[model samples]
Target: MEDTTQYFDKYEENLQREILKMCSSLGMLDGELLASEDIDFKWKEWAPEYIAVALPEVNNYPDFAIACAGYAGMAAAHWWDEDWGRHHSAEFDSLLGPRGFDDMDEHIVQKILGLTLDSVEAKQIMNILLCCAQKASTFIRHEQIEHQTVKAFHIFARTVKVMFRTGAALELKRLGYKFQKVDLNRQLPS
Candidate 1:
């Protein structure tokens, strides 16, 4: 039988490969690419601060993979907020298209939870969740009185909580610890 760590390690590696490929395809793989387009406009100035805060929390992991996942989420939220939906892409319209930021908060949470991701799949799902967390946090910090941003902040907080719990569960399972799927809705008691 394959060791659990091997499974997690392989899963992490595969996720990284996919992230790299997706970023490359979007022309967002590095600093140079960041300068090549309008994508940077949507990235919050507070993103780096959020990333700095997140990095220490995942310090024990090799390559700080958790932080990377969080960063991916932050980036994806910026893109989705600025680039996706009917306003940005005509072909991408859906009934759930950005229906104000408050509705969008619920949408983001639903999107994250609905992923039903395996460890290998978590690479992408976790990234999007973390990104949403960071973006929402930025809005909350900067625009404290905005109702939509506040609601979004709460939703994104749940997202961060869920993402961390999910990652921990995967790691624990990899370490040969038995884990049951904790209802993510109840993952944050209170």
Candidate 2:
């Protein structure tokens, strides 16, 4: 039997491959996201949430994966709102197709939690879950494994969470959302 770490490691590697592929397909360099004096995005903020959603004991794995992905989408939206130039960029719509996917992370969660989509406020929520879900579908798939067990699903859940995070980061990059360092000391007037 393959060690659990080894098993999940494969998923991690493939995920990185896909992420790089996504960046290339979108004509964006992965280097732009690397740390520098100007970058200010703190990815560690989502760690606690990831632990809850991915590591929780669950009765259903697919649902777990879906829920984890949704959480990721919503978290990504939070970061999206931090910038002044948020909606000005057309990257997400162009890449994800059409419109309505701008805040899809939140939309998907709203949808799964039984929120009504008929309200005037929800009119923009439709037709978005699938596109983002599709982006993560490949990561959650479990074909190569010889046996489909609860263990595999758990890994899938973790994979789903990570893939969604990565996708969001890529989208944010494409949308021109960079984390600019805010040096409080520098901003203080003498």
Candidate 3:
């Protein structure tokens, strides 16, 4: 895996920062999310690779997109643990919707948190996800002529990663968790 962040342009970096801030504003940044810091940007490296692996399981664009969402959900499941690929063929097999993604995120949140996904929060997050998806798709189509490389795919993958993590962060906020910040420049008590 590469430190793919180095490849991100200004707009992509700004978009990434805003989405993450939205997570914090919505109060989705929790221990589970923070725990992933040890990973740094590893998810950025693995998310797009999962896209190629997911080709056989999906039939169209929506399914492919949802599959990436599921990949993000699974990452949230184990604190973005080892990139063991997706559990698409494992226990999460049941969560896949026949024609679309469905409530593909149900199992992980329900099983782990014992809380249901709030419809309102889902709607808000869905809006953000859709926006991110559109940008990614646009990049893929328009980028091939210029970059002529996989940079577009990497950007799209990072979008997928942020979208799902935003969902988890929303859930964490719904569960009453908030992101805490440290004062790096605080003076110690004398």
Candidate 4:
């Protein structure tokens, strides 16, 4: 099997474009308002590639946009390991809805995480998560605030926490790191 780095190299361009498109779709890209420099770069540099990948010709299907967005977020996490990717991952989790939460136990979390960092599973899952994250981040950054922004932000935060926890566990497992299983109620440090 190919290593994570090797796998990512193949999809990095597509991942970047997918992230950009998701961000744009979420309305996060704004030229006028001055926010964090990193955020600006994320929109300008990363988002376009996302757009390219998510374009109808590239993705073909309607749902492909969402899938591309998720993939973008996952790829960003793998590449940057910075705030942009992290936030994008969080957003992706929010979009994924509640379907996967029940299985967020240590074993499942470990398995997913191991799969993610180790490139064990098809990269599609990672791609989905990344795309979701990019969309969420874009929403948070660009959308005008009403009651919905608060709700969305909350969801985004929760999702990010879950993904990070699971992703971290997987990374640890891949590295042959061991840990004790603790209660799920307690929050893991960010």
Candidate 5:
């Protein structure tokens, strides 16, 4: 019988081959193709800070890759905030409304959530959640002031959590990883 370690090694080899095959089929495994995309947005967003703390030995990863990693880290941080922070605070309610917050733009929501309305899947979900949040926050502030409802708070929290998770996924996809579901609870701050 084969040893357990040998089985594990064979499994790993098979996984690597499958991943390489998929990458090749998608035309993403080629170094030239990787180099061709304008990952300048990611690089500009992440390079300086990474360079500041990078270890000398592993400095060869492309700027875009480092930027993508940094974005993933930031998304993790934001998820923590959504999970633990008092997302339904009076201040937050006051900032969302039919008239909208004086300083808030719908676009600001996209920027905060790191989403764009251009993609069909992302656009549909984001539009629904953002509109719901805006309306719910407004209702809480203007209509529900007499009594705070668990239902309202639940809606608020769910919306915020979705926004954070969606943002994280977008950033990860931008970095070229096939996004799996983010485990939000695992990211909650201790």
Candidate 6:
């Protein structure tokens, strides 16, 4: 992935910064890199790449591919981890519609994530997420204007959040890290 952030306008950059801030506010950025520290601008670069890999056969399917990945990520999180409980935002649920949340424990999404990561390293995954973010940013902007809602924005946030966590888990699996089920209340600090 090349340095794609150079192509992002001031609003786009600010949007990315807002995401990092959201992560921090939600306690999701405990040990993760801040947006400013993204010196290589990997986040936005990987967003489109993720779309490509998700729907390679479709020539112009970025939106569909992104929605698919986002839905899959949401489903996979619950399937992969017993303690993984999403806050279940009503707005996000409405945006995804009835069919999207119907297949939370499905195998197809898991397979997609596995296949997507099968040929990549950590840096590659980071790039993929960044690129995915870029596409999501565009989708959010367009949807916001066309529909006058922020559901598109939440979709981007929740999707990227899941993707980042899933990517980290996949990388740890690649590094021979063992995953053990734990009680959330009984967890120890890293």
Q: Highest lDDT among the candidates is held by which one?
A: 3
Write model 2 residue lDDT over 54-109, tens digit each, in one string. Answer: 44433344333343443344335434545525522323222121223333444443
> Where is the poorest 10-residue window by lDDT in model 1?
31-40
Task: List per-candidate RMSD values in Å.
Answer: 20.0, 10.6, 6.8, 18.0, 21.0, 14.8
lDDT of each: 0.36, 0.45, 0.47, 0.37, 0.35, 0.40
Best by TM-score: 3
Error of 5 at 38 (Å): 28
For candidate 5, write residues 1-190 as lDDT tens digits.
3574464445434433433343345443331112211232333343344333322212242222222232322234333334424321212222222543322223333443455557664454344334333432443354342333544433333323323333343333435555246877686676
Off by over 4 Å in 4: 1-40, 82-190
lDDT of 4 at 88: 44
Q: Please give the lDDT score at residue 147 for candidate 2.
A: 35
Error of 6 at 144 (Å): 8.1
Better of 1 and 5 by lDDT: 1
**Cα lDDT tens digits for candidate 1, 1-190:** 3574464345434444444344445333331111212222222332343334444443243122233333333334333444445323221112121662213223433453233344443445445445433443443345344443544433333334333333323322222344235776666556
For lDDT, candidate 5 versus 6, the one ahead is 6
Model 6 lDDT tens row, 1-190: 1343342343345544554454445433432432221211233443444433443422354444443443444333333342323422212232233354333213233432333334444234434445545556564555444332344333444445444444343333333445346888886879
Expressed as tens digits, the lDDT of each residue in 1-190 for candidate 4 is 3564454343433334444354335443221111233333333344444444333322244233433333333333333333444454333233222443222222222332334444534443444345554444454345343433444433333333323322332322323444446898988899
TM-score for each candidate, following the candidate numbering: 0.26, 0.44, 0.50, 0.27, 0.24, 0.28
Candidate 1 residue spans exceeding 4 A from truth:
1-38, 44-46, 62-110, 119-190
Error of 6 at 98 (Å): 20
Q: Give the TM-score of candidate 1.
A: 0.26
Candidate 1: residue 14 Cα off by (Å):
20
